[model samples]
Target: MTIREQLDALSAERILLLDGAMGTMIQKFNLSEADFRGNEFLHHTKPLSGCNDILCITKPAVIASIHQAYLRAGSDIIETNSFNANAISLADYDLQDRAYEINVAAARVARESADRYSTGAKPRFVAGILGPTSKTASISPDVNDPGARSVTWDELEAAYYDSARGLLDGGADILMIETIFDTLNAKAAISAIQKLLDERCSADPEGAAAGRYDVPLMISGTIVDAAGRTLSGQTVEAFCVSVMHGKPWSIGLNCSLGAERLYPHVAALSEIAPVLVSAHPNAGLPNRFGQYDESAQTMAGHIETFLKDGLVNIVGGCCGSTPAHIAEIARIAANYKPRKIPEELASGAAAKTVLSGLEPLVVDPAVGFIDVGERTNVAGSRKFLRLIKEERYDEALSIAREMVEAGASIIDVCMDDALLDAPRAMQKFLNLALADPEIARVPVMVDSSRWEAIE
Candidate 1:
């Protein structure tokens, strides 16, 4: 069935079952982190390592095996192992060209696995997964830091499109946009997916009505810190406002905290949308040894608690969760009576913006005038480079924030270096400025006299 149909069915059913961690399952294969991380290029097929994004590239067979295992264990929905199939994540390993290949293959792998594992009894669904970029949230302005760093929207958009297309092409039942901390990126991803769906629909009039795997879209946010807020400092309530605008078939939490820790957040989110509620938390905090020691039984017990209390519609594992954990969850889940969810939710303004998580750098939508200061431009001054580096971030963020704060809808950033790393420094500075939560979502003016800097 298509994503929309599956979601419609879910609303009528009791609860849905999503699978557990692919990475942890792959780790049982004994592969190193680097090998798993770089699998797309190397093309390792062994099951020694955990399930990595490379499966979408090199080791698709392994990815298939894990998906099949979950099906055998009784999961209703198996998430495609394409979490890092986006262009940006691929770029880190210089595999950007493979974004489409990776995502499409990931979906196909899961599809094949679901078909192979089903005993002709219960039906299974495949969900295409999208994860966040690698950049840290501590530097983003939306998180209230304004100092957190990131990449530009244009750069991110191109990547999101490539990945989204792959998932659509490969025939996924749902598009699962998970582990988002920055709301803007989430908007970009969902918009990218919608754009792809639109393009596909536009491409073939008959197919559009037939709903060729035009999957239901699901958006999930990560509450990373101890406070249970996103890196953008959005409370659960604030984040829900942004998510609801997307009109996802379902909305909930994933990654970041373990199942036990995510309890309160998941409960709160379920109240907002009449859609299905899902949570796939990590095993627990990793230890100094980088080991996630939480047992399947323990994880299942916690999931049981949540399930009994009516806290979630679907339950699974995240970072530290394994197939065993999935097995435990499957066993416990079979006993519960399915609950019904409402088909329609209270309507409101649809979210069209591609940026949501950060506070907009106050811009006077009516005018554009930003300031620039030179506090560290002295000869032979190490402090100058340090401060220049700092100010570029500050200015990018502050101006963006100031623009956001002052109500200047647009801002211009200029980098002058009669100083050092004029070109490189300016590039780094502007990149951060553009990425700053304040300006990360806004347009930027890269003012550099050096032609090289512009390049």
Candidate 2:
């Protein structure tokens, strides 16, 4: 069945249980981070291979086994073991070329697992998971000044297109774009996928945009570091306005925080996107060793808030989570009825999210002009000038960081000289800006007088 059909069938009375942690489970198989990172080497040999060689890549059977375990545990929706199946993250292992093959394999494995375990009960859904590109929106320099960045829409779209096609080809029930921090990247990915679907539909003789061919899309963000804002400095309200376009089948929070920390975000999200308020928080905050100490029982206890507050329609796990945790959450979710949010609360929350496209100008209540620094504009200004002149991009980045700290809303970049290749310099700068959350939201104004230089 199509994803929309499945969503239509879901209700607050019945909470959807998404499967738990892939990376955590994979670690149990005794794979080191380096081994998983080695999957990057396969990019040249096979563009379709996953970098997590210990799990979904080298050992497909393990991934299948995990899916079966979750199904046996009674999960309503088993996310495909493809959260890192996107090209962006895989590029670290030099597996950028194999994005399509790896993603397709990931989806197929999950679908097979679900089908093999099905009996008289309802069929479990396969959610195709799409994560952020390697260039984090929260930390990229270009997020503040796009004109100074290296990564372009064309580049990002090309990568996502491959991954999206792979997932669709493998029959994912829904495209779950998760952990999005930058609204622009989210928009670019969704727009690219929609464009592809539209083209395919237009090519059809019957003009029928029917079946799984038109799979539903879900967009979720990670409020990991920020209280309620993404790394791009997008408040929950601003993010909703920017990324809510095309209307995702579901919209909510995931990653970066535990259930307690996620409460306010979920509460606000449910009010804005009442259709499907999904959440997959970490089992709890990570210990110093970066491990989750919470048990399934402990995690399940926290989920009661969702049941009582009616702030969630889908519940699952993220980092430091497991199938056992999902089992408990699912069990409780099955028994508890979700409360309906009051219309007043929901309506007021929805109104605040309406955003304007004009540049976000932060005029401090204390100081009127805020902070604007000129050091932001030099492609190789004194610091960048030295860096670019000496071909020291790494050093130039340090300068960018200082400029951001000096209160530069928009950095003026001029990388047109012999040492700085405009496009590459811009892409690099943008990637850096977008990765840094502090200034990722600042709007950039191009300072180039030449049209060619600006382009």
Highest lDDT: give the candidate number.
Answer: 2
The candidate 1 region of ten consecutive residues with least summed lDDT is: 351-360
lDDT of 2 by residue, 147-188 (tens): 354466667777778888887777687888888866677877
- Tell me how candidate 2 scores on lDDT: 0.70
* Global lDDT scores for all candidate models: 0.68, 0.70
Error of 1 at 108 (Å): 1.4
Off by over 4 Å in 2: 32-50, 53-57, 137-147, 205-209, 339-353, 356-455
Off by over 4 Å in 1: 1-3, 32-51, 136-149, 338-455
Task: Give the alpha carbon lDDT tens digit for every residue of 43-120 in model 1.
Answer: 533342333676565666667778888887778889988888887776666666777887888888888887676554
**Candidate 1 residue 161 C-alpha distance from true site, Å:** 0.8
